[model samples]
Every structure is written in C-alpha cells, then in structure tokens.
Target: MAYLRWVLGRLTAAALTMTGVSVLIFAAVRAMPGRYSDLVLGPLATTADKAEAARRFGLGGSLPEQYGHWLLNAVQGDFGISMASRTPVSAEFAARLPVTLTLTGLALALTVLVGIPLGVYTGTRGKGGGRTGRLLGSLGLSVPEFVLGSLVVFLFTRYSLGLTVGEYVPWSQDPVRSALSLLLPACVLAVFCVAAVARTTRDAVLGVLVEPHIAAAVARGASVAFIVRHHVLRNASIPVLTLTATLSAYLLGGAVIVERLFNAPGLGSFLVDGLDRRDYAVVQTGVLLAAAVFITTNLLIDLVCGLVDPRISALAGKARS
Candidate 1:
C-alpha cells in the first residue's frame, strides 16, 4: 500500500511537471522573433505565402487555441507534419530513437562500471588513491565532449588503429560492428558522466565515514572492507543515485553536439536538423520527447532510491500528507 501510494504520487507529480514544461516550451518557441512560416518559407517568400504557411501550420489561430489543437494532436500521438521535410514528427523520432538509446545506454554502463568502483576505492583508500582520483577527475571534467570526440576519431579512425570512421551498422543487422562503431563516441560521452559521478560518490562516501555508526564500527575493530561494503556504501549511495538520475536526464538532450560530431543517427541530430530547417513539428516533438525521457528517468530514479532507502519514500509521503 505504501509503495502504491508512492507510485501514484510520483506519477501525479511527473504529469504536472511535464505539463508545465510543455507550456513553457510552447510559449518560448512562439515568442521567438520570427514566425514558423518565416523559417519554413525563407526570407524571400512573399507575404501571401507566409500567411498561407502559417495558416497551414495552425499558427493562424489564437495562441491558446493553437496550443490546444497541438496538444490534442500530440495526445493522440500525431506530432503533425514537419514543414521542412514534410515527414511526420512521430516517424522521424521512431527512426532515430533506437540509435540514441543505444549510444546513451552504452555510455551510461561504462560510466557506472568505471566511475563507482574508482570512487569507492579512492574514498576507502584515502591518500594515494584519492590523489589519483582527483587528477583523473580533473582531466575528464576539463575536456569538452567535442574535443574529446574529435581526438578519439583522429586517433582511432585516421591513425594506426585504422577503425572505420563514422560508419554505423544497425545493431539488429550487425551488433558487433554497431557496438564497435559506437566505442569512440560512447567513451567521449561517458567521460564527463564518469567524472561527475565519481566526484559525487567520493564526497558522499567521505561524508558517510564520519557518521557515528561508522565510527563505532571502526572502534569495534571492523575490517575496512567490511565497514565500506556494508555501512559506508549503503548510506553514501543516496546522493549518488540522485546524481546518476540527473546526469541521465542531461545526456538525453546534451548529446546533440556529440551526436553531430560523430554523425550518429540520434535524436540530437534529428533535433539539430529540424532546427536548421525550422521544422516546427519536428522541433516540438523532439524537445517534448527529450523532456519526457528526462522526467521518466527522474521518476524511475526516485523509485529506485525509495527502494534502496525507505526514508526517501517516507519523506515523500510526509510531504504529500
């Protein structure tokens, strides 16, 4: 019953947040200096053509009515037609979503696998390990994704490594080749994720070490491994969970530049192409889908945190009450 209540509360909150985001996006996009027609028709288009294009895109109606129509169409999974490509926004997303998902998934997996263990080691070992951690973290955080991606491409694709450059094989067609193609880009994307997560985890673990219970365990001659494995890690994990969730949300939209650099068929590339052409339907749908991914990721993270530490769910329940 508690779990069910928690789920319901989260769902309600997520719905409200998503609605607010949609409204803000709608208003912001509409408030941009030019009309949707201006983007689609270009500067040389006559006034009459601009008017006709606006009407076709439903920009002819009052803002509220236009928003309502668009929202209704969206609810029915019709993202309307892209003014630039004349393709359905839903179809565009459908085609590119898998690529983004695959890349992000690989990057995230690498981040967790590499970051957490290294953080734990640094926190537990303190002196030498901590110094090493700081150096690596600084290097990772200082490098931008674009620079990192370029370097990787140069080294792996153009240099002696002789890896194929910017060629993606669909996983369903050839999973090995697809994964191989993704390795450089995924590593570039994962660098920042790993750095941020490692720093957060290290701080959280260090904080946990000073707790009374942890001191008691130390005084009682508990093994370092035992204390770290059982008490310290458990308590420290809460913040790490939140950080991971936030990073995942960031990765969904933040991959645009990286995707473009790699020429990967991801949602970020789709969004960029749409923006370049002033494809209203594509832009709206892609942004909304990214927002949805962020919201969903956050909710799932909250649920996982609640499972890990019942105090989180208790706090949430109290807030609702």
Candidate 2:
C-alpha cells in the first residue's frame, strides 16, 4: 500500500512537471524574435501575407488562448505541420527520434558497463586507484562534448582511420555499418557519463567501505571480494543510481552537440535544423519531447532507487506524515 501510494504520487508529480514544462516551452517559442510567418513566407512577404500566415498558425488570439489551443492540439497528438518541411511535425520526429534514442542508449550502456567497474575497482584499490580515478575523471570532465567530438574527427581524418565519415547511415540498410559509424560519436557522448558515474561510484563505494557494518565485516576477517559483493555494492549503488539519473539529463544535451558535430540524423540534429530554419512547430515539439523524456526517466530512476533502498521509502513516508 505504501509503495502504491508512492508510485501514484510520483505519477502525479510527473504529470504536473510536464504541464509546467509545456507552458514554459510555449512561452519561449512565442518569445523568439522572428515570426513563424516571416520565416515561412519570404522577407518580401506583405503584411496581408504575414497576417494570414499568423492566422493559419492559430496565432490569432492572446498568448493564453494560443497556448491553450496548442496544448489542446498537442494532447490530441497533433503538433501541426512544420513550416520548413511542409510535413507533419509528428511524422518528422517519429523518423528522427529513434536515431537519437539509439545513440543515447549506446552511450549509456557503455557508461554503465565501463564506468561502474572502473569505479568499483578504484574504490577497492584505496589511495592509488583513487588518485588515478581523480586524474582521469578531471580530464574527462574538462573536455566538453563538442571539443571531444572535434578531436575525434581530427584524429580519424588525419590518420585515415577509414572507419567512419561525417554522415549518417540508416540501420535498415546496413546495421553493422551504422553501428560502427555511431561508435565514435557515442564514445564522445559517453565521456561525461563515464566520468560522472565512475567518480560517484568510487565515492559511494569508498563511503560504504568505511561504514560501521563494513568495518565489523572487516574485523571479522571477511574476504574483500565477499564484503564487496555482499554489502558494499548493494549499499553504494543508491548514490550511483542517483548520479546516473542526473547524468542522463546531461546525456540528452550532449547528444545535440555530438549529433551536430557528427552529422547524425538524430532528433538532436532535427531540433537544430528546426531552430536554424525557424520551424516553430518542430522546435517546440522537440523541446517538449525532450523535457518529457527527462521527466519520465527521472521518475523511473526514483522508483528503482526506492526499490533498491528502503531508507528512501522511509524518508518519503516520514516526509508525507
């Protein structure tokens, strides 16, 4: 019953968060300098053309009314047509979302697979690994996504790697080729993910190692591997889980920069394209979708964390009371 209540509360919170995000995005889209009409119709367009274009866009009413209309249509899955592409915004995003998802998924998988173990190992090794981890973490954190991407491009091009070029390949046509092409970009995206997770995991693990129970186990002559497997990892994971959830937001932003740098046909590039062309429908929809994704992801992470640690549930229960 407690868990059920917790889930319901989280769901409610998610809905409200998304509603607020929609309002903010709506306002932001409206606040941009150039009119959608001006972009669609050329600069030479007359006032009559602009007025007609604005009417067609449902920009006929006050700000609140415009937002309400857009929100109503949006809830009904109607994002309207893109001014630049003349195609339905939904169709355009549906085509591009998968590419971004795949890229982010690949990067996240690598981060978890590589970062957690590295952190665990460093945590176990005491001072030496801690120092090394800190050094590497700093290096990883220092390099921004685009800079790393540019470096990758330079190295690959200068050395004639012949593995990838600045173009996207459809997975349907060549799955292996597509995967290979995205590898470098995914790696670039994963840099911060890896650094963040690894550092957090190291800290979490080290903290767990020093806990009274962990000290008791050590005093009892428990094997290092046994202690780590049975206790340390289970306890250390709570903070690491939180870090992973937080970094997921960064991953979304990084995907945009990396996609543009790599010329990948992902939603990131789609959003950039929409912004460049002043495609209001496309840009607003993309931002809202990204916001939705972040909210949903954080909600799931919260649920998982609650499942993994009873203390979180206890804290929530106490807070509610």
Candidate 3:
C-alpha cells in the first residue's frame, strides 16, 4: 500500500511537471520573433495569403487563446498540422520517432553493458585502477558532444573506416545495413555514458568495499570474486542505477547532436528542420514528445529504484516532510 501510494504520488507529480513543461514549450516557441506564415510564404507572399495562413494555423487569436486551443487539441492527441510538411504533426512524428528511439535504446544498452563491468573491475583493483578510471571519466566529461562527434567523423574519414557515415538505412528495409549505419552513432553516443557510469559504479563499489561487512567477508576467507559479486556489486547497484538514470538525459542531448552529425532521420533532425521552417505544430509536438520521453524515463527509473531499494520512498517522504 505504501509503495502504491508512493507510485501514485510520483505519477501525480510527473503529470504536473509535464503540464508545466508543455506550457513553457508553447511559450518559448511563440516567444521567437517572426510568424510561421511569414517563414512559410516569404516576403513574396501577399498580406492576404499571410492572413489566410495564420487563420488556418489558428494563429489569428491572442497568445492565450492560441495556447488554450493548442493545449485542448493536444490533450485529445491532435497535435495540429505541420506548416512545413502540411501533414498532421502526430503523423510526422510517428514516422521519425522510431529512428530516435532505436538510436537512444541501442546507445543506452551499449553503455550499460560496457560500463558496469569496466567499473566493477577498476573498483576492485585499488588505487592505480581508480586513477585510470577517473582520468578516462574526466576526458569523457570534458569533451562536448560536438567535439567528440567531430573527432569520430575525422578518424573514421581519415582512416577509411568501414563504418557507415552520414547515411541512414531503415531497419525495415534492411536490418543488417541499418545496424551497420547506426552502430557508429550509437558508439559515439555511448562515450559519455561509459565515462559517467564507469566512474559512478567504481566509486559506489569502492564505498561498498569499505563497509565493515565487506571486511568481515574478506576476513572470513570469502573469495575476492565471491565477495565482490555478492557484497560489492549488490550494494553499489543503487548508485549505479541513479547514475544511469541521470545519464539518460545526457544521452538524449547527445543524440540530438549525433543524429544531426550522422544525418539520421530522427526527431532531432526533424525538430531542427521544423524550427528552421517556423513550423509551429512540428516544433511544439517535438518538444512535447521530448518532454514526455524525459518524464516517462524518469518515472520508470523511480519505480525501478523503489523496487530495488524500498528505503528510497522513506527517504523521499522524509525529504518532503
């Protein structure tokens, strides 16, 4: 019942958060200078044409009215029509979202698979290993996504690497070609997560290693691998999960740059194109969908944490109190 209540509370908070984010996204897009019709029709378009465009897009009303209209329609799963594509915003996103999802999912999976084991190894190896891991983490942290992406592109180009560059293949058309196309971008996106997760896991494991129980287990002739597997990793999982959850946000940000760099047909490029064309519906829908992704991901993280460590709820309750 406590867990149920906690989950319910979290759901409520997430709903409120998303509502606020939607409003802010609406306002931010509107806050930009120039009208959608102006961008669509250009200077050559007459005033009457501009007015007609504005009216069609529901932009004839006051800001509040326009927002209210959009909000109401959005609640009904009608994201309006994209001024650029002249198609339903939802339809446009439906086409592009899967590419973004595939990139993000693959990147995250790679990060977890590589990061945890590396962190565990370094954490168990003492001071020298810790230094090496920290240095690697610092390098990863310091390098911005664009720079990292540029470096990858340069190396791949200069070395004539067989990896696909700036070409995207849909998985439905050819799974093997699609996998090859996405692999480099996913690997590039995984860099930051690798550094962050590795460092976090190492620190968490080290902290757990110093616990009295760990010393006792060691003294009891428990094998190194046995103690680490049973004692260190288990206790350190909470922090590892926390770091991964936090890094997920960074992964999304990286995806935006990586998608553009790789010419991947994902939401990042779609949103950028929409913004460039002043396609309000597309931009608004993109931002809302991104917010949904962030909210949904965090909510799942919260639930998983609750399952892994029920004490999390008690801590949250105390914090709230």
Candidate 4:
C-alpha cells in the first residue's frame, strides 16, 4: 500500500509537471518571431492572408484559448499538421522518435555500463583503473559533442575504414548496419554523459564510504564486493539516480546535436528541420514530446530509487500523513 501511494504521488507530480511544460512550450512557440502564416504565404501576403493562415492553422485565439484548444486536441492525439510538410505531426514523429530513442538509449547504456564500474573501482581505492577513469572522465567532460562529432567525421573521412559515407540504416531492416551507423554518433553523445555519470557515481560512493555504517561493514570483515553490493550501492543510489535523470535530459539535447553532425534520420534532425522552417506544429510537438519523455523517464528512475530503499516510500507516506 505504501508503494502504491508512492507511485500515485509520483504520477500526480509528473502530470502537473507535464501540464506546466505544455504551457511553457505553447507560449514559447507562439512567441517566436515568425509564424506558419509568414512561411506559407510568403512576404507578398497581405495582413488578411496572414490572419487567415493563422486561423486555418488553429493559431487564431487568445493565448489561453489557443493553449486550451491545443491541449484538448493533443490529448485526443490530434497533434496539429506540420506547416512545412503539411502532414500530421503525430504520424511524422511516430516514425522518427524510435530512431532517436534507440540512439540515445545506446548512448545511455554505454554510459552507465562504463561509468558505474569505473566509479566503484575509484571509490574503493583501486589505483590504476581509478587514475585512467579520472583522466578520461576529465577529458570527456571538457570536450563538446559537436567537436567530438566533427573529429569523428574528419578522422573517418581521412582514414576511410571502408564504411559507406552518409549512410544511416534503420534497425528495422538491417540491425547490424544500423548499429554500426549509430556507433560513432552514439559515442559522441555518450562522451559527456559518461564522464558526468562517472564523476557523480564516484562522489556518491565516496560520500557513502565515509558513513559509520560503511565503517561498521568494513570492520565486520565484509568483502569489498560485498560491502559495495550491500551498502555502498544502495546508499549511493539516490544521487546516482538523480544524476541519471539529469543526464537523460542532457542526452536529449546531445542527440539533436549529434544527429545533425552525423546527418542521422532521427527526431533531433527532424526537430531541427522544423525549427529552421519555423514549422509551429513540428517544433511544438517535438518540444512537448521531449518534455513528456524527460518527465516520464525521471518518474521511472524515481520509482527505481524508491524500490531500492523502502525508506524512500516511507518518506512519501509520511508526507501524505
């Protein structure tokens, strides 16, 4: 019952967060300098033409009214038509979202797999792996995603390791090629996240290590592995989980940058295209979906952290009481 209550509270918070995000995105979209009307009708279009275009595109009402209308339709799965492509935004995103998700998922998996172990090693007083992890983490943190991407492009182009140029194969038809294609871009996307995750994990572990319980475990002759598995990980999880949530948000932006750099057919490039064209439907849908995704990911991570330590659920129960 406590677990149920905890989940319900998280769900409620997520819903409110999504509502606030929708409002911000709506206002920002409307505030951008130009509109679908300006793009579709051209400069020669008169004020009447522009107003009619706005009306046709469902941009006709006051800010609150427009938001209400958009939200209503969006809830029903009617995510407006694209000003640039003249297609339903949902349909367009449906095809591209998986690509971005897959790429980002790969990047995140690599990050966690590499980061946590390195952090554990360092925090546990391992000398060699810890030194290498710290040095690489520092360099990774210092480099920008675009710069890493450009470096990959230059190196690959100059070296020509037999891979096709400008090829982006989808995983549906050919998983191997798709994985190969996504590898470099995924590395670029993961670079900063890996460093950040490693640093955060190391700090969390180190913080837990100084606690009295950790000392008790050590004094009790617990193996390093046993102590880490039983004490350090569980105690350090909240911070690591929080960092993962933040990293997911960072990954969304990095995905967009790397997709453009690699010319990958993902929502990042799709969203960028919409921005370049000033396509209200496309950009709004993209931002709102990304926000929804980020919120949902955080909720799941919170659930995991809560599960790892039921005291967290107890805290939620206390709040309700």
Candidate 5:
C-alpha cells in the first residue's frame, strides 16, 4: 500500500515537473532575440513569405495560445514540424536519439566499470587510496570535455591506438565500426564522471563504515566478508545509485559537446543545429526530451531506493501524511 502510494505520488510529481520544464523550454526559446519566422524565411523573403513561415511555425498566435496548442499536440505525441529541417520534429528526433543513447550507454558502462571499484577500494583501505581517488577525481573534473577529447584524439592518432573519431556508422549498417566510432566519445564523456563516482562512492562507504550498526556487526562475531557485504555495501549503495542517476543526466548534456567534437550526429548536435537556425520545434523537443530523461531517471532512482530500504518508503509516507 505504501509503495503504491509512493508510486502515485512520484507519478504526480513527474507530471508536474515535466509541465514546468515544458513551459520553461517554450518561453526560453521564444524569448531569444530575433524572430523564428525571419530566420526561417530569410530577411530577403517577402511579407507574405514571412507571414506563411510564422503561421506554419505557430508563431502567429500569442505565446500562451501557441503554448497551449503545442502542449496539447505534444501530449498526443505530435511535436509539429521543424522550422529548419521542414520535416516532422518527432521523426528527426527519433532518428537522432539512438546515436546519443548508444554513446550515453557506452559512457555510463565505462563510468560504472571504473568509478565504483576505485571508490570501494579507497573507502575500505587506508588514507593513501582515498587521496589517490580524490586526486584523480579532481583532475578529471577540472579538464573540459573538448580539451580531453582533442588530446585523446591527438594521442591516439600519434600512437595509432584508441577509438577512432570523425566517422560515425550506425550499428544497423556496420556494428563493429559503429561501436568503434562511439568508443572515443564515450570514454571522453565518462572521464570526469568516473572521478566523481569514485569520490562519491568513497565518501558513502566511509560514512557507512562508521555507523553504530557496523560496529555492532563487527563485535557480534560477524565475518569480515559478511559485514562488508551486508552492512557496508548495501548501505553505501544508495548514495552511489543516486549519483549514478544524476550522472546519467549530466552525461546526456555532455553528449552535445562530445558529439560535436567527434562529428557524431546525435541529439546534442541536433540541438546545436536547431539553435543556429532558430528551429524552435527542434530546440524545444531536444531540451524537453533531456528534461524528461532526467525526471524519469530520478523518479526511478527514488523508487529503487525505496525498494532497497523500506525505511525510505516509510519516511516518504509519513512525510506525506
């Protein structure tokens, strides 16, 4: 019952969050200088051409009326036409989404493979390990993705090693080359996140190690492996899980620069192209989708946390009451 209530509450909140995000995206895009119609029809276009472009882009109506129309159609999964591409925004978005998803997936896989273990080792071991993890984390966070990607590409070409860039092949066409194409970008995307995850894990594990329950388990003839596995890891994982979800969203944002840097035609590049051309529908769709991904990831993370720790669900219910 509590879980069901929690789920309902989360769904309500998610709906509200997405609504607010959509409003912000709509307003922010419209608020930009210059006119969408002017951009689409060009300055040399006649008054009638501009008027037609305006009407087609839904810029002929007041902002609120336009928003209402767009929102209504959006709820029905009709995102309208792209002012720049002259194609259905949904179709273009659907086409571009997979490339970003594959890149994000590869990045996340790399992050988890590297971050969690380093964090665990640092947390459980001595100060040396902790310091090392922190150092690596700081360095990773400090470097910009563009610089990292550039340097990596340079070094790879110099040495004839590492993932290839400047050519992206969809898996449907050539799986091996497609996978190879994304690897470099994914690694670049995962670099700082790896550091962050390690630091978060280290802190979380250290926090759990000092709990009274941990000491109790230790003193109660618990095996080292048993205490570490049951008490240390399980308790420490909630924070790690939360960080992972947060990083997923952050990685989505990072995909833009990584994609652009490596010539990968993902949503990030799509958004860039939209902005350059003032393609309102494309911009709105891209940002709104990113917001949705973030909201959904967080909600799912909360639910998973509740399942992992009943106390979380109980606390949520009590708070609601």
Candidate 6:
C-alpha cells in the first residue's frame, strides 16, 4: 500500500511537471524573434508568400487557439510536420530514437561494468590505494566529451588500426560491424560516467564502512569480500543508482557531439540538422523528447531511491500526513 501510494504520487508529479514543460516549450517557441512562417519561407520570400505559408500552416490563429491545437495533436502523438522535411515530427524521432538508444545503452552498460568494480576496489583500498583513484577521477573530470570523441576517432579511425571511418552500420545489416563502430564512442562517453560513478561509489561505500554494524562485522573477522558483498555494496548502491540514472538522462543530449564525430544518424544528429535549417517542429519535438527523457529518468531514480532506502518512503509518508 505504501509503495502504491508512492507510485501514484510520483505519477501525479510527473504529469504536472510534463504539463508545465509543454506549456513553457510552446510559449518559448512562439515567442522566438521571427515568425515560424518567416523561417519556413527564406529571407527572399515576399511578405505575401509568408502570409500564405502562415495560413497554410494554421499559424494565423490566435496564440491560445494555436496552443490548443498543438496540445490536442500532441496528446494524440502527432507532433505536426517538420518545416524542413515536411515529415511528421514523431516519424523523424521514431526513426532516430533507436540509434541513440543503442549507443547510449552500450555506453552506460560499459560504464557500470567498469566503474562499479573499480569503485568498490578503490573504496575498499581507501587512501591506501595510493593516488590511482584520484588520478583516474581527475582524468575523467578533466576531459571533455567532444575532445575525448575526437581523440578516440583519431586513434582508431585516422590511425587505420583496423577501425575504419566510424559510420554506423544498421544492426540488421551487420550486427558485428554496428557493435564495433559503437565501441570507441561508447568508451568516450563512459569516461565521464566512470569517473562520476567511481567517485560517488567510493564515497558512499566508505561512508557505509564506518557504520556501527559494518564495524561490528569487521571486528568479528568478516572477510573483506564478504563485507563488501553483504554490507558495503548494498548500502552504497543507492547513490550509485541515482548517479547512473542522472547520467543516463545526460546521455540523451550529450550524444550530440559524439554522434556527429562518428557520423551516426541518431536524434542528436537530427537535432543539429533541425537547428541548422531552423526547422521549428523538429527542433521543438527533439527538445521536448530530450526533456521527457530527463524527467522520466529522474522520476525513476526517485522511485528506486525510495525502494533502496525505506527512510525516503517514510519521509514521503510523513509529508502526506
């Protein structure tokens, strides 16, 4: 019952938050300096032609009515037609989402696989681990994503050490090639992920190590591995989980530069294309989709946090009371 209540509360919050986002996006887009019609029709287009374009696109209506129409269409999953491609916004996103998802998924998986173990080791070793953790943490923090992407591309693609120009091969066309193409980009993306997660995990685990029960277990001759597996990891994982969720949200937007470097046809590339052309519908949809991903990821993190720490759920209950 408590869990159900928490779920309901989270859903309500998400719906309200999404509503606010939609309104803000709609208003901001409408408030941009030039009219949408003017963007669609180039600078050389006559005023008369702009007027006709506006009428055709139903932009002649009052702002409230236009917003209503957009809201209704959005509710039905119709994000209108892109000014540049004359294709449905949903269709463009649908086509591109999978590629971005695959890339981010691979990157995140590699991050967790490498990060968590290293974090555990570093945490267990504490200051005694020397400066290894600090050095890795510094490198991860210092390197920007685009620079990392470029470096990887140069090393693998420019060097011609078996990695060709990293064009994305469709999974259906050749899964092996597709996987191989993703490796470098994924590794670059994972650098930040690993650094952040490793640092957070180390801190969380070290904090847990000082707890009374942990000390008791340690005093009783609990093996290091057994303490880590049973006590340290389980308690430390909550923050790590939160970090992972937040990083996943960032991956959606952060992929833009990386995708461009690799010439991948993900949503990030599509977003850049939309911006270049001033394709209002495409840009709006892309931004909204990214916002949705970020919000949904955070919400999921909240739920997971509640599960991992009963005290969080209790606090929510107290607020309700």
lDDT per model vs. reference = 0.84, 0.86, 0.86, 0.85, 0.89, 0.83
lDDT (10s digit) by residue, model 5, range 185-245: 9999999999999999999989998999989988899986787788888888899999999
Best by lDDT: 5
Candidate 4 regions off by >4 Å?
A: 1-3, 46-52, 126-133, 162-165, 319-321
Worst 10 residues of 3 by lDDT: 245-254
Clashing pairs in 5: none
Superposed by TM-score, candidate 4 places the C-alpha of residue 20 at a distance from the truth, in angstroms, of 1.1
Give the clash count for model 4. 0
Of the two candidates 5 and 6, the one with more favorable lDDT, higher being better, is 5
Q: 1-321, model 1: which lDDT tens digit per residue?
A: 777799898999999999998898788667656566666777799989977887777677788998998899999998888787776778878888888888888889988999998899888887787798888899989998888888877777667685666888888898888888877778789999999888888888888998899999999999999999899888998888888888887777768877888888888988887777767678788888888988998899888888999988887778878
Residue 316 alpha-carbon offset, candidate 3, angstroms? 3.0
Looking at model 6, which ten-residue stretch has the lowest summed lDDT? Answer: 30-39
Clashing pairs in 6: none
How many clashes does each candidate structure show, in the order listed?
0, 0, 0, 0, 0, 0
By summed lDDT, the worst window of 10 consecutive residues in model 1 runs over 29-38
Mark the regions of model 6 whose C-alpha exceeds 4 Å error after superposition: 44-48, 55-58
lDDT of 4 by residue, 206-254 (tens): 8898999989988999998899998999888788888888888778877
Residue 186 miss distance in model 2 (angstroms): 0.3
lDDT of 2 by residue, 200-287 (tens): 9999999988889998999999999999999999899888888887777777777888898888988887888788777878888999
